[model samples]
Target chain A: ETAVFQTPNYHVTQVGNEVSFNCKQTLGHDTMYWYKQDSKKLLKIMFSYNNKQLIVNETVPRRFSPQSSDKAHLNLRIKSVEPEDSAVYLCASSRTGTEVFFGKGTRLTVV
Target chain B: GQQVQQSPASLVLQEGENAELQCNFSSTATQLQWFYQSPGGSLVSLLSNPSGTKHTGRLTSTTVTKERRSSLHISSSQTTDSGTYLCAIAASGSWQLIFGSGTQLTVMP
Candidate 1:
């Protein structure tokens, strides 16, 4: 019973293809984030949305975009995927200045 | 340029042994959290202590905001505890969190 839900636990796509990951949180949190875990298991923040508004964009590449329909949903879109984009993308949500709950993560493999 | 450093990149412990993980941040944090990721890649929230000592079951967390450091202690470790423990912090006035590389723990039975 995860409060945060992510779709397509795993994805494999061609280098030039585009991919999107969907995330939904039922915890009613105001802040949602997208994090990327590299091959070395290093987690880095890619984007943050507060109440459906983008608040932080950590210098991510222009092809990477975050889409939020509402506060409870924050999805990640990567256009023209590259081999370097292969990694685990995790979705998390939390109240401002509080603990965060993360999804199981979507593993993307760009071949 | 905020950074989070975790010590002892990996640790192995026998069942019933204790383990301690450390985290140091480069800037003042408005929120500090400890998260556990299972081998299957599911992340679970362990503790959230910004500037004080807190405990839950066999886990204890202590954060000294003045020193920008925090620690998580797991007592009576079990094989089920084998996973990666990550420390993350959100700098004051910031909404994004910076995560440490994480400390991988293996509890052997």
Candidate 2:
């Protein structure tokens, strides 16, 4: 049972192109986060949104941006995609100071 | 900055054997969570124990906040339990979870 959902289970795009990944959570959690998992299986925090306000923005590349409409949806957009962007983008949700749940994740391949 | 470290980077066990994975953190943590990552790239949250001990099914998680350490015990291991186990910690007044590299477990029949 997945309360946190992500779109386009897999995506392949070319360099210099733009890509967007969509995420939604039915858990009614006030906090949402986007994490990047590299080929080495290292998970890195990218951005966190709480109650529709962007918070905890890590030092990632400028190409990455998070968009949200209300508290249930958070979307990630990347411009001029790079090979390094070819990894799994995981969307997660949680209540403040509580357990966090993750979605299946969207696999992005930059060709 | 908070850091989470997991020990015994990799482990192998026979079916029915119990396995224990350890986690240590550098700062005060108000929340702790364990996650399992399948080889297929899917992730599942196993348990979230900020302190003391908690159990669900065959998995048990124990966290010592003052000591900044946690341990995950998997009882009666099965081949289906083979995957990577991740430990994460969130410091007080913060919502970000600092994750460890994870411990890979292999269970043989």
Off by over 4 Å in 1: none
**TM per model?**
0.97, 0.98
Which stretches of model 2 miss by more than 4 angstroms? none
| Distance from true location, Cα of B63 in model 1, Å | 0.6
Clashing pairs in 1: none
Can you write out model 2's per-residue Cα lDDT over B2-64, one digit (the tens) per residue?
788998999999999999999999999999999999897688999999999999999999998
Model 2, global lDDT: 0.93
DockQ of 2: 0.83
lDDT of each: 0.93, 0.93
lDDT of 2 by residue, A1-111 (tens): 899999989999999999999999999999999999998898888999987668755578988999999789999999889998999999999998899999999999999
Question: Could you give candidate 1's per-residue lDDT for residues A24-104 as a string of tens digits?
Answer: 999989999999999999899998888656865646899999998989999999989999999999999999878888999
lDDT score at residue B65, model 2, on the 0-100 scale: 88
